[model samples]
Target: MYLKCGLLEDAEKFFGEIPLGNVVSWIAMITGYGKHGLGKEAVNSFNKMQSENIKPDAVYLAVLTACSHSGLLEESQEILLRLCCDSMVKPQVEHFSCMVDVLGRSGWVQEAKNIIECMPIRPNAGI
Candidate 1:
């Protein structure tokens, strides 16, 4: 509610008050924070979600988007690796796109090209 309205603090405060904050709640906060360019807050919320034993599913695309927007390149790379190796989460075209965007934004165009070349699935138009 507040998030969509650009009221980040209010949204975060309301979110924190939820007694049984589920993945949906967390996603709302993360997505809102990301959209607002509050990348660190989004990442922190994600860490807290993990601490609560919430396993991120495909919806973590929001987090990657946040990281990409903020140029959190190293963190994004680590997340990409973890999504592949540790969590067994399938990387979608959106995920790869986020990485490429992050790399390109951070002036690592060569790296982005490398990732596109090495994609397990054929690089889509989005990438």
Candidate 2:
């Protein structure tokens, strides 16, 4: 609710009060931060979630989207690379799309094109 209303501080405070933050709650925080263009906060929340032993699932997309929106090219690339190396989480087409968006937004059109070309899955309209 707070996040939806753009009350990030209130949202963060409430989130911190939760006794046991789950993946879903963490996703909310990350996606909320992304929606507000707070990429650093989103990344910090991602790291905190991991430190709490909450393994990321679809939340990867949220983080990627956050980085893309904030033009964090290097962070996006690092996250993509980490995703590729993590056997637990398989890189999906959506993840690739976010990476492309980040790269393209950062004026790395050729890199974006290369990423699309090397994608294991077929590019969809979303890409």
Candidate 3:
């Protein structure tokens, strides 16, 4: 639970000591890194997870949000797209919101709006 509360070092130690990690363990580390504003570390954790063939679910979107928080829009876009197109995870409104936020934060408000407009499914508010 160190990762859950923003303890990166302890979380890293825990992760390193474990020979095998479940989805929750990996996601916890990714989320922890993201929460602590370590966007690149979060992305690296994501890479580690994928290398282990662990499929990401909605929670991994936390990493996407972290990307936006850190102004890494391009990487956020690529990661989000990969989650859908390559990893086979379905895109939900939360993912779309992350895209919108990323684009908007990057000053591509028009692109963000267009994405919302052209979305196959309309985004419901209050996600």
Every candidate's CA RMSD: 1.2, 0.8, 1.8
Best by lDDT: 2
Q: After superposition, how far is residue 124 of candidate 2 from its true place, in Å?
A: 1.0
Report the lDDT tens digits of candidate 2 across residue range 1-127.
8999999999999999999999899999999999999999998888888888888988899999999999999888888887888889999999999999999998999999999999998999888
**Runs with alpha carbons beyond 4 Å of true place in candidate 1:** none
Task: Encode model 3's per-residue lDDT on 35-110: one tens digit a residue.
Answer: 7788888888788788988777755587887787777787888887787785457787888788888799889999
What are the TM-scores, per candidate, against the unseen true structure?
0.93, 0.97, 0.89
lDDT of 2 at 102: 92
Model 2 is weakest, by summed lDDT over 10 consecutive residues, at 78-87
Candidate numbers sorted by TM-score from highest down: 2, 1, 3
TM-score-wise, the better of 1 and 3 is: 1
For all candidates in order, the CA lDDT equals: 0.85, 0.92, 0.79
Clashing pairs in 1: none
The all-Cα superposition gives candidate 2 an RMSD in Å to the true structure of 0.8
